[model samples]
Target: MNLEVLSQHMNLISLVVLAVVVAIGFIKKINIGFFSIGAAFILGLAGQMSAKDISKGFSSSMFVTLVGVTFFFGMASQNGTLDLFSKKIVALVGKRTYLIPILMFALSAFISAIGPGHIAAGILMTTFAVYLAFELDINPMATALYAKLGANAGCASTLSMTGILAKNLSEPLGYTGFGTHLFLTTLLSGFVFTLILYIYYKGYKVKGDNPLKLSDIPAFNRDQKITVAAIVIMVVACIGFKLDTGLFAFVAAAVLILLGCADEKKAIKSIPWGTLMLICGVGVLVNVIDKLGGITLVSDFLSSHMNQSTAAPIMAATSGILSWVSSTTGVVMPTLYPICDNIVKTFGSNVSYVELISAVTATSFAAAISPLSTGGAIIMSSYSAAKETTTDEMNKMFKTLFLLSVMNVVINVIMAALGVFNLGHLFY
Candidate 1:
């Protein structure tokens, strides 16, 4: 075959194999990364690529960033620091159970924005929020959803894991200085949906909790104090001075371990190794696909179906659908972000790349509440742990959570359509 024909064949081969890999991930028993590596090898062979060509797709930078940040926060999470901090925040509303949901939203947002980002915050906050739901006699799902939303809202900050990853993915695509813009848009979108959830769950009616005394809550111990300080410093360093996030996290985590405040083994184990692997592995596949023209296909498909006015929201809607079964940071962002440049080209000069970026990001995270996603899975497991449940109840909860996820995604898409995500245009 000629070079052009071989290139087309390689693109088709990589795209089809990627589809199979992603479908296999949905099987629940398989990790997609393994298949992705093998698929990349196949593409490498087909395209006359060297082994280095296949392996180069592995993003060591992204891996280190994910590992360092998660390990650092993992130490804090395992040390009871975050838990105690959560309780202290919950104590703010005192018997005003109606306000607990909003409080949880803000608490999660603050925790996430400060450093750990949504993945860590969602796991920690969703569990806490669900427990509070039962304790405060409120809607468990609603509370969990609010906390999840809050986690997502604050996760896009420059200091946080997702924010860093978003920048890493977007910057190479020529979308520089959009991190702060993306952060603001995601934060605002998060609050808008959180308020919708609060009203829907009737936050004004949540009652029947006795006051939690501030004195009854223990003050931060030395280790917890150190950990909190490290987080704050990391935030300032990354945002104000523009230090590397992953390296700073490693320094903070090492200090915590050296001080005997956090267990090294436990913290290491707490990191989501599987998720990290999936991220890097799928990145390999996506990189290969991009090299082979799969991204061109995506751009063509989008251009065929969408216009300038609808382009941003269309991307939002597509991202929302894919995010139900994919990682927003890992799979969705890396794979789809490259299409932004092409999107701008196809839709017209007036298309705001920042808005498109914001819409896709905000909408993808909107679907994080799906039971298939980590946030929803945590809510499910935490609820089951705290209460006696039957199979039917679990099934119902899953469906209800999925529906709520749809609601959240729909709101994000509508906001994107209405130019709400255009808020980022100011900063851009």
Candidate 2:
């Protein structure tokens, strides 16, 4: 319990070093690459890792997993598939002001389940909602609110990049099927949350055009049409659920490029390489820090010291906070999963690992809705300033997003408590 004794643990020291590196990375406004690499090297030395092992910390495999997937999302965007999809949705909802938020939820949930990340889904949906606003003749704030709602709903689904917190929760809970369960539970949650939004924002009046007519919409550009087709095929592939989601995205992206929907130049420009690199860097660094600092060892030791029954809430809260700070599920999962696993082992209770994993996954995904949360920040940043609308309208849009996020978190926590989709096992 003493500070001196805790200081001796490699995981503890590694964590301290990681915290410092992250702080510096933020201050510099650069990728966390240096911090990650530094953490990896220091942890390697402290954990008695060899040069080869340390080198593996920056492995291409990790980059392929993160960056490759991201590029594909970018490729899809470049191809105009997203635009076309949004256009079609807008065409369907045209001047039906009340139905906008409802459609936002449905479209976002389905699209994000197969997209690169939840933020991608959020951005696409929000942008589309803006276009819809133009069609409906609504103020920017209402359009922006629907967009924010789409982002939140879409991000909550199983395909969400943010949803990977389940994987981490699985490792700690000793739950091998956590991913499967979390995926299902999240889908249901998405629908429920969407319904809530739809009901809350019902009955706005606006009559301008017919609600349904595909023939009235113009065809997309040739290249854009191709991209749209490719996205559809990729979505089908993902729903078939045969391969790794990341791999699926990578392949889809490559196919889009090969088909001339997005060339190499376009693909490179489309993707968010900065964010991908940052995640990869932080991910490897966090692993190294854990190894060198023996933070896990200390967690294990303390877990051993506590009543197993009482640690569940603490673990859940910790996972939620960590997920919020790190943003990437990849960065947070590896760091937390092992600790959860240790707790499960120490407790030896009837609670399955999947339950623990599901609990954490549900809560962690919910965290993204907070204004300071990663998904929230991304969505807010993607909001283009409205030239036609007043600044007051834009401010109102931001407030709507904040309100939407609070609703999402409240719904998720309530669902978790109600054992909706067996989430109660997280604490029980």
Candidate 3:
């Protein structure tokens, strides 16, 4: 075979390997990242890539960010700071059971907007949100959905990883001020989803006569107070001062540990290493795919099949589908953003670059509620660990979460097709 033919075959094989990695991870209950790394090794050899070339795919920055944020939050969890905050918030809502979901949503969104991003915020909020649902007789599925959506709402904040990635990706295409646009689009989508969940769950009907007084809620102890102060400092430094989020998070974690606010060993163990590995491994494979011409093959196919009018929704749907089972930042955006960029170039004035990017971003995040995604898995695990959850209830919640995930994908696609989040005018 000629060199060109061999190259083409390698590209096709890489694509197949990528799909198989996802499939085996889903079906065999294996860590998708582990398989992704294995696939990368095979594809690198097929493409005649050097070991160093393949290793370059691992994103040290992203890995550090994940570790620092998750470790800090984990220490907060260990020290009961998150619990204290949750209890106080619930007490403030006192008897207005309907407000529980709204409050949780707001809190989660605020935390995400400040800097931890959606995954960390979702993990923190889903735990307490589901617990509150059980205590308040609210639908755990609805609560979980609200928590995850709320996190996504603020995920596009300028300080968050999602926002940073979107901004960096958009600027090269001559689309400026995309970070704010992405944030607005994601926030609007999240609000719409939250409203749908609220209505579906009959939140308006919930009421209780008992309203807890402020005094009844426990005050923060010395350790909790220090933890809270550390978090506040992290937010101010990372957001207001534009400090490195990962570095700031690590500093805060260290302070907490040294101050005896959190146990050293447990806090160290609490970092979500598996999630980090999954993201980094997928990143390596995606880089390999790009190197092998797999991305070009896929982008060309999309361009051939889609015009300006259909491209936004098609790409949105594609992102939502893939992100449900893979890392949104690592797999979905890295792979699809280039395709969207190609579409914009192909259609020229016919396409709005900002709108296309926003749609893709929103769609990718909306699917984070799927059980396979980190946020959804956290919710499911939290619910299962709850003492109030019976086996039957757990099964029912699983079904509900699955259905909700599907609904979110459909809603995002429709929203993108209708240009509901067309915020290009806001930036331009």
Each prediction's total of clashing residue pairs, residues at least 3 apart in sequence or on different chains, is 0, 12, 0
Q: How accurate is candidate 1 locally (lDDT)?
A: 0.84
Candidates' TM-scores?
0.95, 0.78, 0.88
Worst 10 residues of 2 by lDDT: 164-173
TM-score of candidate 1 on Cα atoms, chains taken together: 0.95
> Residue 130 of candidate 2: its Cα lDDT?
55
Off by over 4 Å in 3: 2-4, 164-177, 209-213, 349-354, 372-374, 387-396
Leading candidate by lDDT: 1
Over 1-428, each residue of candidate 3 has an lDDT whose tens digit, in order, gives 68768776887878888888887877787777777888898789879999899998877776777678778877877888876776777677766677877887888887788666787788878877777677666677778778878998888887676876665445544666566777889888888888998898887776644244567878998989998899889878976787877888889888988888988788778776776687678878978987888877887888898887788888889998888777787667766776677677778888877787788888888888877777778888987777566789767766777788789889989998887768547655
- Give the candidate order by descending TM-score: 1, 3, 2
The residue-by-residue lDDT of candidate 1 on 256-346, one tens digit each, is 9889899899999999888788878888888888887788788888888988888888999999998998778767887778787778877
lDDT of each: 0.84, 0.59, 0.78
